[model samples]
Target: MDVSDILASQISKHKSILVEKDVPLDTDVGFLTVTDPSVVDKESYDHDREAYLQSTARDGIQHLLAALFSLPTLPSPEGPLAQLPPPTTQLPRAKPLPKPKPPTKWQRFARAKGISSQRRDKKIWDDERQAWVPRWGWRGKNRDEETQWLHEVPANADADHDPSKEARVARKERTAKNERQRLQNVARAQQGRTTATATGTQVDRKRDINRTLATTRMSTASMGKFDRVLDGEKKLRGVKRKFDPIEKSVDAEKSANLALIKQIGNGAPGGSSLKKVKRDGLDSESGGNGGAGGVVNVRKAVRFASGGQGAAALARKSVVGSGSDGRQKRRGKR
Candidate 1:
């Protein structure tokens, strides 16, 4: 037969063998057909035919051996392999790691032996009772209004009145008194007067003046000599220039005395003329010319007796009546 006829017959035989072995023949398994003579080369066709025959023979032998020995079938890629269990020899079981234990109280104490422990209790030292006291529990700091030591009674203690009770009663009385005083102050304020308690008595006034003088003396004593002199001069100036309504009455009294002195110096009756001058001055406020003239004469006489200068020197010195340089120097020496 020719090459084509021989190849076709061989292909038909292989097809029948595959069918008996239950191997499905698709495109990969070459089958010679009459209409396609150039499908595969001679060398390639021979190699493919050999491989197909070998694979089919191997599969048939394996199946026959399995059936004869009654052995389990080898796993296939799609079926047996997927349902197979994983190899135990490849992956051994792993035991869980052990847990670490916590530190004990003794270990903690050793770690913090040198450091101070944090306090949770509210106990404080009581100086009066000489003991430690809890602030807010039973027998706490606020159990009694008085201190614990103060509340303690002796074995021989008599049934005397309680000092704490007495203090409370006194405090209440003082509060009532203060309330009454406040009402009195309000009433006094409505009447346009200061509170009675605020008003100083004559004795208090005298005491205050004495205190002021004592303080003044003390302050002056503490000053330097030059400062003391300046302070004294300032005080003298203030006294000389200070004017008051009281001073006017004092001046009137002094003038009356001066008039009496003048009358006595002139050998005239003092009381009668003085009375007459005052009566006339009172009767006509604008007609005090006689009394004025008499005062001038008395002033001149007194100035002359004191070795004072004349009207010309008086005018030069102005109202202060400072004398000549010689007298001023003499007074300075004194």
Candidate 2:
């Protein structure tokens, strides 16, 4: 008993009302039809019939009326439409116009022969004459008064013209140029050969000098002088100087060792165990392993030397002999 119940009750009542109202048999024909059949007068009926005819006539002939009243309507043609004539209007024909007058005898001669003068055209305003005077010449304004330089064709010499003179001149110039170039090329080639032979001789001389230098041995006379100095130093009374080679070498070794120890100590903070092993390998190579390790060590030493002064200490201390103690440690003893 809520909104649905109310809606159902209203729909049921409206359905019955619609059923009764919609029955064809229950419809009132009397109310729909005119009550008096004679109520329409003859005038009214005729007027209504006339009005209907007028409305249909207006609706049906509206287009025809428009056509009849239209201005400038076109007429339809049969078969092919006649071709329209082309427009007569066209651009004006250009006139020959007036020709200008000549300036000098030479210019007139060149212009009459249809040759252009090297002189440029110049226009100047003449105050007295009230006209422009040109520097170079031109044809006159009046055709009849124009300078008559035109000539009639010669009867005898009109048949032949030859270009062999110009052709011969061009060929001569070309031949001269080619001959000059050929001479230059031959001179250049001769000079090049002489220079090459000179260079070869110089190179051969240098090679000979180097070979002689390499094969020649030092003289014992130089060593004999050094031995004399040593003997004199020993015999000198109370002038004993400690200039022993063995002592100098030992001192140098000790100094180098000290420098190496100093360098190792300075780099110890940043040094890795791997670097120590690499240094050991380098030592083995410098001692004359001469393998890949030797090459690597060479590169490393060069790089370290380039890096800073620390490499100087290491280089000074490093022994440059075969391995550490002059032994090829890996090979079996021979």
Candidate 3:
């Protein structure tokens, strides 16, 4: 018998899914996105809606697969994987480009003098120390004279003059001068940034001055409270506060109530306070298992009276059994 013809007929029934569009699908291989600009057939879509939707989806998938298979593939353990090319689309940045930092005072001076800035190593050779030492910090070559015990006094020096004290003062002054210049540079850069408009510049300058003044006031012995108050000075503000704790959990309250019920059931001390609990069973949750005079649970009492038959079956025995939706009626006739 020729069963090959039957098998061939079965196989030919499902041909490759063909995608036909007016403008063709815009395929981005990098992002694996396909945009179809063709208009849908409303008559075909409205009639046989489910089949139409399935056909449309099948077309899209067929087009995507065709595009993917066209690309070169690399061999993998599972199968050959297509290598996606770089994206051709340019995307905008999430945030605006940051402003460049303003040049420092020394940087500007160096530029004016046509001097290229060069960074030197932190450690330097010292003649007196006879070893590699820091250029300008603790025990540095610059501070050798300040730490030296012996000093050659000048020819016309005062009797009470101290060489060590003089060296220390000079070092401190140099450091203070450097710090002052650094602060001035920072202030100048800020001023340049804030000077977008004349009125805005004045407002920013005043705000900066007030902030500096406030800092000085807070640095006082009494924290500006006992210090002499200047006219029109605004009071300092602290973080918002409250007496009670935030985000109190309900679980603790539930546990407390359960414990109280259990305690009263056990007949604990201080009976007067728990008088209400003893009198009433509170609710069905109590199950009437509290105190000497406990009200029985209604459901349990009914079950016992009916000899193990549930409430519903016992109820149906007397009257005509009613349907859950109340559609059933008297069964006297039909």
By descending lDDT, how would the candidates be arranged? 3, 1, 2
User: Can you tell me which runs of candidate 1 are displaced by over 4 Å?
Assistant: 1-161, 192-239, 242-334
What is the RMSD of candidate 2?
35.7
Give every collision pair in model 1: none
The digit string of per-residue lDDT tens for model 3 on 1-334 reads 9999999999899895667777788777787777677788999999999999888777777898888888999999999999998765557879999989899999999999999989988999987668999988877788788778789999999999999889989989999999999999999998887667756868888989988977888998888889877799778875587654554579866787788998878766556766756445454224333332335555575566446876655556434545432211111111
Which portions of model 3 show Cα errors greater than 4 Å?
1-96, 127-131, 198-334
- Candidate 1: C-alpha RMSD after superposition: 39.9
Model 1 over residues 172-253: C-alpha lDDT tens digits?
Answer: 6766887786676556454444345455564688879977765564466544334445444433212257554554677798
lDDT, candidate 2, 163-279, per-residue tens: 343444665676688778667666655555579677888799998986564333223455333433433343213336885365567778899789889888765545788987877
Return the top candidate by TM-score: 3
Q: What lDDT does candidate 3 reach at residue 44?
A: 97
Top-down TM-score ranking: 3, 1, 2
lDDT against true structure, model 1: 0.52
Residue pairs of candidate 2 with colliding backbone atoms = 100-139, 287-321, 287-322, 287-323
